[model samples]
Target: MFKIMIVEDDPKIREIVLENITKWGFDGLGVEDFSEVFNTFIKYEPHLILMDINLPSFDGFYWCNKIREVSKVPIIFVSSRNTNMDIIMAVNMGGDDFIQKPFSLEVLMAKMNAILRRTYSYTSVESNIIEHNGAALNLKDSTIIYNEHKLELTKNEFKIIYLLMKNNGGVVSRDKIMRSLWEDESFVDDNTLTVNINRLRKKLADIGLDNFIQTKKGQGYIIL
Candidate 1:
């Protein structure tokens, strides 16, 4: 089942939305700690987010931008602020849609369904970017951007990082990586894999992402 996370601060609204989401046959999560919104997002990895503009600690826009740094998950701004500028800013901040406050639950569900369908229906449509921990790897260009600095990757480097980032937060065994490389027609022995991994780590460190990929001894590598 698709999981939807609600980031609204209002208890009443959050409760109502959660109830409706359950009725709509989707799993729902509500954020209780506004201070740890981003961390919560990382842990839940929800398919969609419902964010309110006026949130504690940080506004919705701030959290949205932060989340966008590491994910392309669809976000919808549900707020009382209805200015044209608000709508424009919402779109600019990577929100898929904006819903004014006091919205009908039915309409909210409809918009959510539409976005979910468009985003998840086509298996062939892959996002050209994969992001984690403030770094974005561009699949189209074989480059990684972090802290406003961009660095190009060699073919092997790109393939390794791509595989790791695609499985971020999970251990990718050495054997699995080698098999992937073999399937790509670039056969590499164990020693070569170590060299490539070291090189990639150096490049990532140069871009200020030190220890981005962690070694799970007796297991393999992982990007957390």
Candidate 2:
């Protein structure tokens, strides 16, 4: 089932939204810890989000930007502020839709359905993901997910991981990695590939995935 995360602080509004979500046969994850919306988001991995413009600690715009850094999950802004500027900001922050306050649940559901359909309808099964030992590389966002922990990666870092994960059980040579990242490696610095690999390994380590990308001395790297 698709999960919908609600980031509104008001208890009444949160309950109402969740009720409607349940009625529509979708799971609703209400955020209680506003101080760590991103943490809660990582835990839920919601397919869609209902975010309020006004939030504790940080505003929805800030959280929206953070989420966009790693995910393309659909976000719909629900706020009382209906000014043109607010709506524009919502769009700019990667919100799929903006629903004015005091909206009927029907309207909210309609918007959610429309956005969900549009976002997921044309999704092809040619998976844009590569996985090894529970570490998943999202090709579309250039991020990694390991044990529910996510890390956004740089372009070179992503290419490195992609090459390793694509050849999961086999040791990919450093030369092959450089070639995959840049068509021509002669112009690249000798240590650039090592630097990128080290960075990617550190990121993987941060998410409880230590030694995920195993080094084979002079053989290159492998995700065993």
In terms of TM-score, which candidate is strongest? 1
Model 2 ranges off by over 4 Å:
124-137, 141-224
lDDT by residue (tens digit), candidate 2, 127-211: 4566676666778888887655778898888888888778868999999988888888999997998888888778888998888
Q: On residues 132-201, what C-alpha lDDT tens digit does candidate 1 reach at each position?
A: 8767787877988776577999888888899899997799999888887777535555788888899889
Model 2: C-alpha RMSD to truth? Answer: 5.7
Please give the distance, in angstroms, between residue 188's alpha carbon in candidate 1 and its true position after superposition: 7.3
Number of clashes recorded per candidate = 0, 0
TM-score of 2: 0.65
